[model samples]
Target: MSRTASDQSLDGLADGSSVVVVSPERIDPDARVRDFDQLSASAQRLFVSEEETNPATAADLDPGDVVRFTDYYRVR
Candidate 1:
């Protein structure tokens, strides 16, 4: 069964709490996010290339991919 934000009925379940964990993709500072019809000044900003994660990120991605949120303002 799908989980929700609040479903405390898992008390009787043998497994861990029925609480669902939501992990949203965080926009990296270096990554460029489309705001509207155009790209912002973040053109210099590099972002995760859809293969990386905040934690437990596998090297399945590229190096130029945004590895950290602070990679943008870190400066060259």
Candidate 2:
């Protein structure tokens, strides 16, 4: 699918930057409202609201808000 502002925003991130993943489904209210890192240490992945998720492609998204997972990484 084509990209959107949110997708472009994420693409602009520096290599190895810490990022919390989110899809187009049921975004964790906590994560959506608060910081992604605020979740528990074990919670490497968090949900994102439809308004917050990127790549605004219907094909990319599931019936509900999608859930994406990724480890937090920082550039050295």
Candidate 3:
């Protein structure tokens, strides 16, 4: 997965940075959207890691975290 400008912008963020996480599958009117810090530990760990080539899950996401989706782009 190629990094977009939005992805690049997330580089070097401090650990625990506030992030609004959005999932393509949950983009319905009734779906809830929440920030990274607001998520439960299990939910936060479920997001796909930014590093597509690695096995890292969102569990390892910190300092420079991002969520990757197969069919969506980061919304600024």
Candidate 4:
């Protein structure tokens, strides 16, 4: 959507309240802005929003899969 310079004049904006994210570029009447992409809010499921647990946390490994090194030099 496009708003003309006059359409974007401060008269259209209500007093004491404004959008939290007004682009400073929009403050100039001569400047025109159009959003090609915008972020919208949607409630995401807990499966996606919740912290993905670390698979290794509190995990017990099979003895065969465990590897331990006695020397730090081995890491290089």
Top candidate, metric lDDT: 3
Best prediction by TM-score: 3
Report the Cα lDDT for candidate 2. 0.31
Report, for every candidate in turn, its global Cα lDDT versus the true structure: 0.26, 0.31, 0.39, 0.22
Query: Candidate 1 has which clashing residue pairs, if any?
Result: 30-45, 30-46, 31-46, 47-66
Model 2 — TM-score against the truth?
A: 0.18
Over the stretch 1-76, how does candidate 1's per-residue lDDT look in tens digits? 1222222332353443222222224334564322221323333122222322221122222322322232221111
- Give the candidates in order of lDDT, highest first: 3, 2, 1, 4
lDDT of 4 by residue, 1-76 (tens): 0111222443553432111123343333542322212111221121112343211122231111111212100000
- Candidate 4, 64: how far from true, in Å? 61
Candidate 2 lDDT at 33 equals: 35
- The whole-model C-alpha lDDT of candidate 4 against the native structure comes to 0.22
Clashing pairs in 4: none
Model 3 lDDT on a 0 to 1 scale: 0.39
Q: Could you give the candidate ranking by TM-score, starting with the highest?
A: 3, 2, 1, 4
Clashing pairs in 2: 24-65, 25-65, 25-66, 26-65, 27-47, 27-48
Candidate 4 C-alpha error for residue 22, in Å: 11
Which ten-residue region of model 4 has the weakest summed lDDT?
67-76
